[model samples]
Structures are given as C-alpha cells and as structure tokens.
Target: MDKLEEITSDGVAVCQPGLRLGQLESEARKKGWELRMYPSTLVKASVGGFLAGGSGGIGSVAHGGLRDFDTVRAFEVVTMEKKPRVVLHEGPAVHEILHAWGTNGILTRIWFALTPAVEWMQLTAAFSTYEEAFQFAESIATGNTWTKRLATVFEWPIPSFFTPIKRLVRADKSLVLIMIAASQADALHAAAIAAGGEVTFTGAFDGPRTQPLLSDYTWNHTTLWAMKADPAYTYLQCGFSLTECREQFRKLRERYGQEILFHIEFMKNGDGVVIPGAIPLVRFSTEERLNDMIAFCRSIGVFVANPHVNYLEDGGRFRPDNIQLLAKQRYDPRGLLNPGKMISFRKQVVTK
Candidate 1:
C-alpha cells in the first residue's frame, strides 16, 4: 500500500498508484476530505489504471476528466528501459502517458487533488418524454443551487433493466438519475416539477427500501445492463457540445427511433458549459451497420470515442497520439511494456 502520506491543510492527498480509489476515498472520509473526482468504476479501478486510461466518470460533470492538467498534480512512473528507471513526471509531462492505455510506462504513485466530502442523495425522476428528462438533468447540472456528482438521462426501456429499482420506475417513462448534495434535495424536486417531470425516487443507497447505488446505472455500466439483457447489443461513447448534442439527439431519435435507446451523462465542457456524453444503446445488427452509424455521427460533427476497439489510436481520439508515441520512445526504449497497444509504436518497430 502506498503510504497515505501528507494530506495538506487543503485536501490534496499523494498516494501510490496501486491504491484503489474506493479505499483512498474511505480513508479520506475519515479525515473529512474526499477525492474531488473519480470514475463510476471507483470500486475496482486503481489510481494508476484510471490515470492511464484517462477515463471520465461520475464526478466528471463537475470536475472534468483526468486529461485536465490539474486533475493529477504529479506521477512517479517506471520506464521499461533496460535497467528500468523510476522517473517523476509533473504538470504537462503527465499528459504524455495519460490515456496511453499503459503502453509506455508503469505508473507507481500519484499526487491527487482532493476536496471536502459531502453527503449525497441518490435520486431519480421520470418524464413523459426523453427531452423533458434530459432538460431536467441539464437544469440540475447547470443549476447554481446544487452540487451534482452525477446527472444521467435514460430513455424509457433502459430503466427497466435496472431490476433493483424496477418497483420505483414505471414502464414507459423516460428517466433522470442523479446524485446531488443532500442540501439541494428541495431544489432538485422543484426543478423536476418545473421541467414537467415527477420526482420518483429520493433517498439514500441503503435506505429502508435499498437499491444499488445510482452511479452503478450510469456511464458504461448502463451498457452492461443492456448487454446482460441481450448479448447482441453493443454501445458507443460519443461527446457533443451542449448545443449540438440536443439537435443530434433529436435527429437520431427521429431516424433510428426505438432502434437506438437514448442515454446521456451530462457534464461541463472545458468552457464550463453543459455538454452530453452520450452512450446510446444500439440494436446490434451487424458490424458494418455499427461502423455506418459511427460514420454517420462523425459526418454530422459528433465526436465518437469508439469503445469497441482495443488499440489506443483507434479509440477516443481516432488516431495515433503523437505525444504518447514520443513518450513511449523516450521511456520504453525496448518496447517491452504493454506491447502492441500503441499502433504508432508497432509501426516504429516495423520500420526499424
């Protein structure tokens, strides 16, 4: 276990990469501090893997993702050079290996930013239409009154898969799922009413009628539920600016309609405005059709972060990240760590 070294007067905590996010969060809670942000996979994800994968999850709506230069203050990574050296990378240098899929170096320790912990209420709301639910979620996310940790929207049938919450959810209504500070409970209820939706479930995770933590039903976990219901279904991760997202969602809903069940995680973009990170459940017909769907979205200006592929370049950015390649060349001279995950490195091997 990496020592839970100094937690400064401010809430920052420096920890070993092997530390589980949940474990660290638990420790932080004892000190009245908590991780400012973490993916929904907090239970199983490690600080190192979270940084390496450069993923965004539950808290992303408020604090943004790991790629933000400030998310990680520093890192100690071990290179794959013949003798193997532990090098410290700080500030901008951290970006070189971030989201590289661990193709370049082994992350050993990390300096994480922390904040005061808040007691959040797990809640849900239902709407007659997807647009209303999405609007309510956007309102809550953008509302100055509430500190939202999670704001998710799911179309009608998708909520049915959340079996534990089935009794709380109705069959045909679209849904809005949220985790917000307990202080803002009334505000969320009023917002839901103003948006013309019903506040359906409002309580804690282990209340009298307990249900799975609301975070479990957001992000890619939603895909897991759909997949379990039917193995043939696959999902996509796409990001669209707040302006374009609403329009794109309307078009897809009108075009594919029920064929593609709508789901979105609302978050603030770099500019601090609300944007939707969409993970619409697709009715898998064929691989070719999936590609066509992705292509069509790109043509319409939607940035699809393809999740079906294993290669780093073929994923989120859709091309070889030159920065990561350069870092690999500098730190992993032997190409010994996580080989073949970086397409550019593989090409370098072929050329040399």
Candidate 2:
C-alpha cells in the first residue's frame, strides 16, 4: 500500500511491489497515464504478483507480457541467502525472477513502463455464430483505424453465464467483448456492422453500470463465469496462430462438440501480429481425459499452455528456463523462498 511514486509525464511509474494494480492505475489516471500492461484481476493483483507469476491480461495485445522485458524496467529483490542482500536488477536481468513464481527472490519494488491513458469504453457486439464473432474480433484486433485494449469472442450460449447482464446478451447470438478508445467508437461500430455483427452494448466503466466490468467477463474470467453456471467444468490455455486458427477451431468443436465451449481472446504476438488464443471451457471428466485433450490439441499444432498443473514450467513451456535457473542460484541459494515451484531448482539439487 505504501510507495506510491510519481508518474512521469512519459508514463513511467516506480512503486513498492505491494501496491494494488487498480490503485496504481487510478492514481495514474489522474495524471492521464496508465500501466502499459495489466491482468484482468487488476483490483486484486499486486505489482509483485503480476511480475513474479508472469501474467498477461488486457493490454497484452499491445505490450506483451511481464516477461517482455520492456514492460518491467527494474526489480528490487531481497535475496533468500544466509546473508540476505538487496539486489537491484535492470533490463532483461530482471527476467531471472520475473516469472520464477517467487521461488528465486522476494520482489520488494518494481518500475513499470506506462502509456497514455485513454477513455476506454466497454462494447459488446453480437454475431449470428461463433465463427463470425471470431472473424470480427480478429479484424478489430488487427485493424489500424481503431485501437483496442481487449477483444474477446465467446461461443454461443456462453454469454448466458453473465446473469447480471442477461438482458444484454441474446440466447442465439455469440458475443464479442471489446474495450476501445472512446474516440474510435463510431469506427469500431462501423467495422462491427460491416463484419455482420450488432453493437449491443457500449459505455464507460463508470457510466451507469449495473453489471460487472466488461473485462471481468473476458480473459480467464470467461472460464469463471462458466464454472459458476455449471460446476462441472475446467479450462485450457492454448494459442492458435492465424494460419491454424480456423482449421483447429473447427476440428476441436467437432471433436468435443458441446462438451467444450470455445472462447477466444485475440492478442498480438511478440512481433505485433494478431493471433487468436483459446481458453476452452471443458466439461470435466477425469485427469486422464484432460491430459489426452492437451495432447490432441498440441498434435494439431496448437500451443497449449497447460493450466491444470501448479509448477511454473508445467504450466507454461514444460521445460526449465535457464534464466530463472541462474537467478535462483544467485538469489535463493538455500531455496527457502516459495519452495517446490521451480522444477529446475529441485533437479539441480538432486544432481548435486
């Protein structure tokens, strides 16, 4: 809660890691500045958690994730050694603990890159089918005339989970959730109409809202909504390159059918190319079936970032990260902090 630093005119803000992201954002908003990237759970997520956990959320389409290096300018960590020392890592060196799940070091403070704040409006467009919604989301995500903070498509019937805003969603229509610059509303509306969608809802976050914020319905929140409506569900995290999106999407739908509800969030890659990433709300069966589904998705060239596991590597790349390994060795030599999260650290000790 302390260390609320001043936001630079250029949009950089340095503060204590304990500060909530939502509070920081509100402070910066007064100065017309905003964090370049933030997860949807901003109100509850801390600056430290976002970095140490390696999170990506709303602004990732433009700013990438916390691991992007530029997103985080610096990290001040307290080592977990017998003689603990304060270490300040700059630039890419911060990556050592950036997503180490707090296994490598304790983050005490962080410096984040910020951007000019915009009056963002939450808008939802309805389409006749999930396919049209997907195509329309991609177009707006990659469009030049209108910039967006978020673009997510939900398959038909999934919108029913938003019981708070049941009137906004139609039973027969799929939903496209978006957050765009208020100035570009007309352009976005035109694009949606041209793409065979109806702009159903549009308003600011504070503008007479009866339901939760639009972002709370997108991202992993979509999965939460589904789980609320039907407790018999889990979710998967997978990325589909533009080239493989249509084919893989169709194949998965055909294979899982109603058992898997398709939801996709459009994001730009490291190179700023648009791609559709899926978080399929899966009807729970057994662990074996989940593993089989992950394997099947990967076999079809879909990159599955497994969410069912707890280990950092298992949840992500499924292999040891060299940078994280080096950081743990230097900062948490005794491995007293957040044990059992880094698979590589355990293996290193066994080998020794």
Candidate 3:
C-alpha cells in the first residue's frame, strides 16, 4: 500500500512480481482504481519490466494471457511536459505501454480491469513420446472449453544407440508436464483424452509446486550433476507453441545434439497470438553452452526477447496493446530503449 501510494503521489515507474498482484488489485478495487499485473516472480524481476514486456503466467492456458488481464485500465505515467500525467486510456493506449519494454513513456502506476477469481482444478498429462505428447498439446490449444491451466510436452531421450546415432534417442525425451487449472477438471480430462494426452496427475501439485524443491534457481540444473551415470542433467528454457514445440525438439537434437533433460511445462497462450502460449522451458544445465543453446532456440523461431520475458510464459502479466504503442510514440520516438527490444515501429512517431 505504501509503495502504491508513493507512486500515486509522485507518479514514477513501479514494478512488482505476481505474488503481490493481489495487493495491487485489492488496492485498486478499494479505491475504485485499477492496475496492470505481471504474473510471475519478483525474485529477480521488476514490476514495469515484466508486464511492460508481455509476460503471462501459470494460469494463462485457461484464464487467458497477461495482455488479456491488461486489456482495460488507467495508467499513472510520467510525461514529456516535465510533469506527471494520469491517463484514463484503454485498448490502444494500454498497448502503447504494455510490453514495449519501457521504450514508451515510463509507467509509474497501472490499473487493470479485475478478473473474477475462481476455484482452480489443477492437472497434468505425461506421454511416452514427443509425438504423443505434442498431439495432446495441439488439441488443447484449439479446444473450446475454458477449463485448462497449461498444456506442456516433456522428453527423455535414450542413450546414444550406435555410439554415433544420427537422430536423438528416445531416452532423451524425459518428463515434461502440461500443467493446467480449470473450472471443470472433468472437462479438461475429456479434452485431454480427445487430444491424445495422458493424464499425469490432477490437483494438489504433488512434490514441489515450483519444481526442483527450490524457490529461486531456474534454467538448466545440469551444471553440477554426478558424472557417474548422473541420471540428472541441466535444463534450458524455451518459449514455443504446440506447433513450434515439435520443430524445436527437432532443432535441439539437430543443432546441439543434446537431448531433453527432463521437464518442459507447456501452457496455453490464452489467445495464442504473437507470444503464443507462454511456454515454460527447463533445461538441466547452465554450463559453457548457454550462448549456443540460446542461439539454437532463436534460429528455430522462438522469440528470445528478454530472460524475464519468459517469466510471463508461466503466467505473469503486462499492459494491453494500444497503450504500449502510444507510450512508444511519445517517449521513445527513436526506439532506442533497448534497441531491438520490444517496440518495433518508432520512425512513424518521428514522421508525425
């Protein structure tokens, strides 16, 4: 409350993580105000940074993506007039600022239309093969029901077949979980069946909700695995669609020759456009292959904007479309915030 009051009073950029969204939302609701919420973690991310960049969250697959939540609201922002401004804008105005990565005017405070919270039904589906696993993903992406949390595909390839196997092994395809929380668990289960998905679990998120039994450590955990038949390896993070997931799997095998470590949390993109289903990627290691791993991911069609951007893949939020665009025009006519960051067109701002 204090932080928010400070921003409302001074009108400066303020960012926070998902766990605190309730605080902001409640505050807005109390004063008949609103806000933009980035739905991930605050461990290493900032408020303006995440939502300002198109991040979603674990609940997106069923509830809708971050941008959906940011669709309506007021923005407390700084202006070029050498003073602050309270912009009561929606649609385009919101987009101008949302996910533009601060190229537009800086957002001191943001308010979003509150979504009705609901009781969630958590579930998962694990398959033996990537083909079977991904088949489930496609169906969920195109489903009509609103009872889904996430749809993921995991892999655990087998050992090198001939000491020189060409294609990656099945063992390389390990455990990937497509997590989802829905209004109706049974409906999601039926959809999973129609989609060729195998139900791994339902509700309770057994054994570490955040996974890895740790709060902060993300990415390939393979750096310090046991060399003696070390069943454990590092992981990598990638944002891809059901369609892109298969191709990416192929690329990982073809490019790096490294197999899937264990888990890939495949969630929904809500509307499945642009960022398309915020997918959670977990590679087991962070060794000397970070650069190569990232390059390989990009070459295969994934948008590698910012590391924090991926947090949205798990359910973080950002502002809407138009607002983000306007912010881009007024504040960063040069599009030089991060150069090739988020905002794509700025010369038109200059042209005007």
Q: Tens-digit lDDT track for model 1 on 1-352? A: 5566767777778887778887787888778887767776777778888888757788878877776538788888888876779999899888887888788888887888877887778888899988788888887777766798889999989998888778668779999999888888777788788888888889864321235677778888899888988887788888866777778877777767677888888776656666887888999898888898899889778889888888888797522448888888988876777887876774234233
What tens digits encode model 2's per-residue C-alpha lDDT throughout 175-257?
A: 99988888888888888899999888888754212255887787888888889999998899989879878898878878878
Give the winner by lDDT.
2
RMSD of 3: 9.6
- Of candidate 3, the 10-residue stretch with the lowest lDDT total is 213-222
Q: Is 1 or 2 the stronger prediction by TM-score?
A: 2
In model 1, where do residues sit more than 4 Å from their true spots? 1-3, 205-211, 318-321, 346-352
Which candidate's TM-score is highest? 2
Candidate 2 segments whose C-alpha is farther than 4 A from its true place: 206-212, 317-321, 347-352
C-alpha RMSD of each candidate structure in angstroms: 2.8, 2.6, 9.6
Q: Per-model C-alpha lDDT, please?
A: 0.79, 0.80, 0.45
- Write down the worst ten-residue block by lDDT for model 2: 203-212
| Stronger candidate by TM-score (2 vs 3) | 2
